[model samples]
Target: MKTQNQFQLFKERRFLPYFFVQFFGALNDNIFKNALLTLIAFGAFNQETRELLTNLGALLFILPFFLFSALAGQLADKYKKAHIIRYIKFVEILIMGCATIAFWHHQLALLFVILFFMGSHSAFFAPVKYSILPQYLERDELVGGNGLVEMGTFVAILLGTILGILLIRIHTSTLFISIAIMLTAVLGFMTSLWIPNQKTISNPDLKINWEPFSQTWYVLKRAASQRTIFLTILGISWFWFFGSVIITQLYNYNQDILHGNEAVMILMISILSIGIGLGSLSCEKLSRHKVEIGLVPFGSIGLTLITIDLSFAHGLYPEQVINVSTFLSHWEGWHILIDLFFFGIFGGLYSVPLYVLLQSRTEEKERSQMIAANSVLNALFMVVASLFSIALLTLGLSIPQLFLVIGFCNLAVTMYLYKLLPEFLMRFIAWLLINCIYRVKITGIENIPEEGPAIITCNHVSLVDPIVVMASCHRPIRFVMDHQIFKIPLLKFVFQTAGCIPVASEKENPEIKERAFALVKEALDRGELIGLFPEGSLTSNGNIQQFRKGLERILNNNPVPVVPMAVQGLWGSFFSRRYGKAMLHWPRQFLFSKIGLQITKPIPPEEFNLEELKNITQNLRGDWE
Candidate 1:
């Protein structure tokens, strides 16, 4: 059993510096923006000028991505990312210095220009920020790495925004705010110096395109070549869009429908931020470190339902105006708070998997570019969301109504995407079943190799075997499944998203057999683990089948270690032969069933003989046969 302390992940150099850099960046961004927005909101500027300034501030922030994102992607691919990030931080310090001056002089135009420069810095940093994760961490750590980043970013945002608002009351705190922002930038720059230099993967011979918008489309089109990757990016963009809309609306909703003040607004933001932080942390526990995206759909559903409930809870606007203190006395405010919390929880679920997917699937050379593209899309979506909000308001929709409409739209869009790719939903179901119904106890799991290419040969006794391995294995495994099983109603989607490899005998599908062999070789070359069941199909009579030749091909070509494993006491379960069909009946005490996985010590590739390996695996199964 891994103890709670064992999960403290920040000790690794690959993660720590990046974590702090991101943390401080988020902190500085929100602090400056919120302080500026708060000043505008509280009538520091005349009401007529405040709205224009606020609108201009938002436009300046988003415009950089539209103009510079492609160049940012090119730069990230052309140079060492750590160096790029370091320079970006230096730029941030300069921009913050400018912001401090603006704050001192009370120059709104100057502050807005500084905000645009900050956005420019962020546009360039965005790609390197996400693209660096896969370069440093192992595949299994991707989920945890992303979770920490997400949690840290949001926590920083929460603190920055809250502090910005609170500091405004001090009246003489401008110098302190300026100093803090500059220090944050300096600290982030120092941390960037520690980021290991990552090699660029794009074609150096490629010419740079001058036209930004056209180049952006070209980059996006390239990403579109991979259907799953494209959809994943779209999903990520939508999440940002949805988040910006709800958060912006929550501000107005709290002020109007909930009749709350700035403190209540901050409370709403804090709850949502904390909820996401908690949800992001939960992924490590729920997924056991694998990038299980099934949670995305589950989170999306909760976000949709809770958002609608918040809308319904809004009720008719009260004729009597209420202050923040009085609003806290009402039940409706509490309900809205609850809804925001869940919305954030689901938001975390929705975003983390998309990050993992991008890291795992995108090509190394193009990774930063892909991430840059995602950032651009996110910015674009935010712009669209802003427009949507303004349009809805013009249509005489209240903030609460706008929330309901967008929330419903979010649900509709999510459903459409999930229907197109059922794997997202299917993986969620499989993940839920494993987490809820089974408390898997893995024995000899340490016997699995810690590094390098390896084959995990196990018996195929149940439909859930791959998922079980996925849940328990400390490293990522590309399992070879029977070709037909890949077509199983919802199982196909789960398998696809999980990146399972489908295989068949030469007698079954010669082309697929060759393709599977090539994929195994490729994965091995990349030092990834590939799992295969030597028993070509699930046991028909609750006994091991003859070992097949595919294992020999994998071992001979890859020349990697082999770890033999056995799944005990699963042959008669719902998915096994005793049930006669997959999940035909639920066992009365299903949750109590003691399924076991025993892993044998790794056999070096040089010592691995086909017949000998089969015997070793057979022995591990013991009396289960």
Candidate 2:
């Protein structure tokens, strides 16, 4: 099914009300937290007490995610998510009401108590916010849905923070801030009332553990049971850690490096947030509304590069405080802003897909627990990140130096993840090639099985046939490519990481050919998908070459179902020989060139034959040649 733009989701009732509820929830949280921080910072407390209170306030908010997330996950799993959200929002109204009294009477202790409750509110809401999406959206809508949620979250945060800062500067700061928080909470509760109810995925009769420590352990153990899910959780945590480090240091980065005042700080934050919003929105377009892990590496790489650039981009301006307008007047200011913008853009790219992956891959019954686990780890990582930043600064590392270290560390961490899950790297390459070079449209993708062994045979029309097929298919596919093409320097890494089988003609390397067949059989026997081009090589003429016997050999040995797919519009692509030699002549269009892929029903191994497979693929190609 064709995907609607992420924005279009707002027009539908299923998503719009939920979006407003979440938006207002985040908005209120930031408004209250930032106002409290600002009050403590500029209020009448002594330097020691003020600093202690400020830090404690931040810690107070994060503490609940650690202590209450297990229970929160349990409730979300056990109850209808939308209903839970309404109850949570009602609690938020009560909490904000208490906050109003606290702020009105200037009761610091009471305000601190309210802060903890607010954190608790967020902790409970976290699991429900993410896990409910799968119940609300289609599998294909996960990416776009997540992107919109993330974008909305950050944008709301930005606006909330701005409002907090502006409102807190008023003469009756406390009263104004209190009114704002209470109003937002009431609005959030009203929005929650409009959210449609969704069925809980967890067992209704499932036992609930009331002990926080034991329940947290139980949830953590469950998360660790699934290796892929656990790694994805870790990936999400690392991104939080990485992003937090940069954000925490930005205040210092602005003061010490950019030598900017408050307005300049806001300007930098606006650029960063806008960049993230844009990058998050772009993920759906890039992934074709699919959960594409390829963007994870792509995003991580860009984040690292941009961070390194930011590290260098600083220290160029004069060490004198300037307002946003004055800072913008300088060329050096634009440089710094550009780096900040891209840093956020890449950060968004790195994060949204993994969130979608976590949502889509986990079983419905346990999904909330998985999200709670993610929140717990995310909090841990952020705490560690705070300590790391302090340690780095204590070591006399400059802010720019800190960024440089983070950049290199990101490179190391992503490489490790790529090593851990080569599928992520495979999808990254395929996503990059398809998005950058060609516009690929996939049809009949449902023909591929959602699980179990299947051999997908496509006519080899271009060098990039495997990539296009990989990007389109929901499941990861091990491709069988010519040994020489597999050995090509840059392309080799992609193929090897994707676990592609390298084959040679029997006359050239019979041993390697035999091993390739063995790998294909092994993959099939394991119920994994394997892709092959029956033509053995890319077509020299824009016509289907005679089918090879390799498919016959594989089906005979493993007898897995065979899926025949065809690439139609690639005959004249730059990767194809319809021009001169592929890639040698550069006379074709650069971007948005149309390409098409069509898949036929899976042929049972007993019914599969070389001639029949070839005919179906050719017919699917039709007039595109």
Say which candidate scores most in TM-score: 2
Residue-wise C-alpha lDDT for candidate 2, range 282-362, written one tens digit per residue? 999888777889889989999989988888876467766778888888777899899989988998899999999999889
Q: What is the C-alpha lDDT of each candidate?
A: 0.79, 0.85
Off by over 4 Å in 1: 1-9, 12-14, 44-56, 193-211, 315-325, 443-456, 470-563, 579-586, 592-594, 600-614, 622-625
lDDT score, residue 170, model 1? 62
- For model 1, give the 10-residue run with minimal summed lDDT: 1-10
RMSD of each: 4.6, 3.4
lDDT of 1: 0.79
Question: Model 2 off-target regions past 4 Å?
Answer: 1-3, 40-56, 107-113, 252-261, 314-321, 441-453, 482-489, 502-522, 525-527, 538-542, 549-561, 569-595, 601-609, 622-625
Range of the 10 consecutive residues with the lowest summed lDDT in candidate 2: 46-55
TM-score of each candidate? 0.83, 0.89
Tens-place lDDT digits, model 1, residues 446-477: 77876788889888888888888766774667
